[model samples]
Every structure is written in structure tokens, then in C-alpha cells.
Target: MKNQEGHDNSMNTLNRTTVSLLTCVVLFASFAYAQGEYGANDFRIKVDARGQVASFHDAVHRRERLVPTQPAPLVAVKKGDKTEEPSRAEFEKEPPLIRLHYEDCGVSLDIAVQETESHVSFEIIRAEPSDKVDAVIWGTVSCDHQQDGG
Candidate 1:
């Protein structure tokens, strides 16, 4: 009876260990699929195309998502003529840039994005220099989250 009890205890321990390991793997995979990844070396980033920057990860940090809530780089395009904003053209689309032509006002903002190993950058180039300034577009990013990717 003593030997049987010892064997049962060992089995219980193994079962608990297996369950715990499985739970961890499932959780990690879930975290991974929650975002789409893009990177330039260590400057890896994730964006979900929800008018937000989804995550940013690096070597110094575990494989955790740095941005989990709120839209990132809130971009707003305004036209002096009160023209409606263009519908949903992603910053992550096939090419990471947008060109807005305001023929009504004779101006445009040629916006470009440059992502690097340590930085995600954007550039707004005027199609031509003009005080006519038909529209303005901008963004803001804020996150200080710490979650172990492991």
C-alpha cells in the first residue's frame, strides 16, 4: 500500500506539470497571433490597422506587446474646404505612404513612413511649397507597458 501511494503521488505530479506546460504554450501563441509583425532589425513593430500601432518589441525586452490599448499615432487629415477625410488607406498598406491631392485648393501633403531597427519615423513632404496649405495630417504615440513575452 505504501509503494502504491508513492506511485500515485508521482503520477499526480507529472499530470500537474504537463497541464501547466500546456497552459503556458497556449498563452504564448495567443499573444503572438494578436498582432501582425514588421521590423527593421531590432526596431521590430506590430500594427493591426485599427488606426493604431499594435506592438513594439526588442531584444532587451521579452517577446511581449508594448502597445495593448488605445489607437496609436492618431492621424487626422483636414482640408480647408471641409472636404471629407479619405476613407481608410492604411499606413501599412503595400507601400507605407499616402498622397492626398486637393485639386480644389491646389495643394497636397505627401506623407512617408520610414521604419528602422531602433525607430519608426514619418515624413510629410509638401507636393509644392505653398502658404495655400490645403490640409494637415498628424499622429501621436503613447505606451509604457511591460509584459514578459515568455
Candidate 2:
């Protein structure tokens, strides 16, 4: 009887450890792929942690335009002949803005977004150390072939 009780306690400890490990895995997964969705009017955008546009949905057309897993990245800054992409991205929900930080080049780009009944627009409102920034390049977006009827 004592041996049986000891075995039960060991099993319980193992089960608790497994559960704790699983919980940590779930938390890490969520953090690693964290993304934000923002929309106004008929356009919706999903931006991932690496400052990539994971999804671009146009509600009126019933279409998704951007391929999230393509080799292309979003919002890069060109310094001289070298181009640096955002190492991280932060978003603001109130006015619909995304700030892309190019840590390597010490530059940041603030993109302001606006939507009307029939149109959506994006403008670069600010670029820190503008002298260091030669150009801000938005990444190439690949069309969804199915949506394109290709």
C-alpha cells in the first residue's frame, strides 16, 4: 500500500510538470507570432511583430492582397546603398498608425493611415534622423493569384 501511494505521488508530480511545460509553450508561441489588426472603413490590415503586413483585406472587393509568408518584408529604410528593415514594430490603435523601427540604422518611420468611404491612404508622417534616411521603401506585396483569377 505504501508503494502504491508513492507511485501515485510521482505520477502527480510528473503530470504537473508536463502541464507547466505546456503552458509555457503556449505563452511563448503567442508572443513569438504576436500581431495586431487595424481597420477603418472597408480596409483591414494585419501587421506582425517583425513589421510585416501579414494580411491586407479589402472588404468591399472581398479580397486579400498580401501574401504573409513571402520573402519580402514591409517598411524598410534605405541608408545610402544599404537598406535596413524594421527589427520591430509598434502600433497605435487610436488613429491607426504603425511605427517601424530600424534599429540597425537608428531610424524610425511613422506611417499614418486614413480611410474614407471609398479609399484608404497611407502617408509617412515622420522619419527620425531624416538625414540618415535616403528613402523609405514599402515592401513588395504579392497578389493572391486566386483572388486575381489567375
Q: For residues 1-150, what per-residue lDDT tens digits would candidate 1 score against the true structure?
A: 225556667677789999999999976544333334556665566555343455666646645445556455434445565643323323324346544445445555555667676666757754544566555555445556555565
Candidate 2's residue-wise lDDT over 1-150, tens digit each? 226556667677789999999999976554344666767677787778778878889776878867756845567888889988788877665567777888889988888877676666678999998998988887776757564343
Name the TM-score of candidate 2: 0.65
Task: Pick the lDDT winner.
Answer: 2
Cα lDDT for residue 83, candidate 1:
41
Among these predictions, the greatest TM-score belongs to: 2
Error of 1 at 64 (Å): 3.9
RMSD of each: 17.4, 8.8
Model 1's TM-score against the true structure: 0.41
**Scored by CA lDDT, what does every candidate get?**
0.53, 0.76
Off by over 4 Å in 1: 1-38, 78-87, 91-110, 126-137, 145-150
TM-score of each: 0.41, 0.65
